[model samples]
Target: MESKTTKKVTRGRPVCEIKQAEQKAKLIFSAKQLLNIKSYSQITIRDIASEASINSAMIKYYFGGKENLFVELIQSIADEQFSQFEDLGEHKKPVYLFIRRFGEILQSHPGIVHLLSEEVLNKTTPLARAFMAAFPARVSKFLPPLIQQETGISDTKKAKLAAFQLITLLVSPYILKTLRQQAWQIDDTEIQGEAWAKDLYRHFIYGLKESNTNEVES
Candidate 1:
């Protein structure tokens, strides 16, 4: 019988590569955490490095600079948020469930809303402008398809309009938290939770269906 030879298979990533990847991830995570508590203008490379327990030079080496790091952070957040809506397309759940889950996500990660608001008000930097432009385009890409799927409304214009309305409803409470509490006696936590989600869903469905009926009649 001929001797059999077997090649050894590599099982996992190299230790150094794994460590390097982990270090990069730590930087990203630290940036996100700090952004949650402080605005972009206030956060520094040293602050992020301190938070991540890595050298500040590593941030410059890995991401080039603070602005680039922040832009990457915003991209990651937008990707995550848009991914949630993509799942809805596969399951085809009721629109109410989508609204409720969206509210829950916003409430859980209020930092994202705050960051978006800040970018809109302070559109002085290229990073801010890129983020502001990318976000709505991302939403428009995912939302109208989902609305069409749920409501069976084929009018692209109406679907887009409804999408804008739903987005406004979902985000307004968190964006205007202080004003909401003082003027409307409603807090962000309450507004972006299950109860408010359900109420908004009911009202939205009613309005959507009524509008569709009017469109068909006309």
Candidate 2:
């Protein structure tokens, strides 16, 4: 981890090395927790610092500001959730990946659901737009025609929509779990987000199987 203090590297020395994830994850985790209690706009640098027991300046040093920090943490969750899409080139079946990754997002900072209000989901913010834009472009590193192969949806628009729908279906249980918590009637543990995501994927893939495809030949 970089020092709590950023130092001038003597003459040509590189800027202080980036902090290790273990050292830094605490701050992220802390900020995530605080974000749950209040909207991102209501939460301040002081809140995050107090929660994490670190200096306010650390927020600036690590993330530059709250907006950036929220974006980064959300991006981090997306990374964990989409890792299989990144690895398997998006052409691979999503079911196997959805279960594991859905579990990952659940286990890892599922708390962020508190901050991710429906207002934000409905209204397009620059940070959210930037996140949405950058994410699938990388996935498109593997998506585009794989989408074509899968759904026979060749138009770029349709393919992207398919990707978004598949991702949404996989991740919706996190939000549902949050809703269940708000309802306060059921055990969150009993919700089974991962299994549900896998089962939905199973149904989706089974339904998407084409009549003229090789499976039909068999």
Q: List the global CA lDDT of all models.
A: 0.78, 0.60
The residue ranges of model 2 lying beyond 4 angstroms of the native Cα positions read: 1-26, 36-42, 61-63, 76-84, 89-95, 134-159, 176-194, 210-218
- Candidate 1: list runs displaced more than 4 Å: 1-15, 92-94, 121-124
Lowest-lDDT window of 10 residues in candidate 1? 7-16
Clashes of each: 0, 0
Clashing pairs in 1: none
How well is each residue in 59-102 modelled by candidate 1, as lDDT tens digits? Answer: 87778999888788778877776666656777655577678767
lDDT of 2 at 27: 72
lDDT of 2 at 19: 40
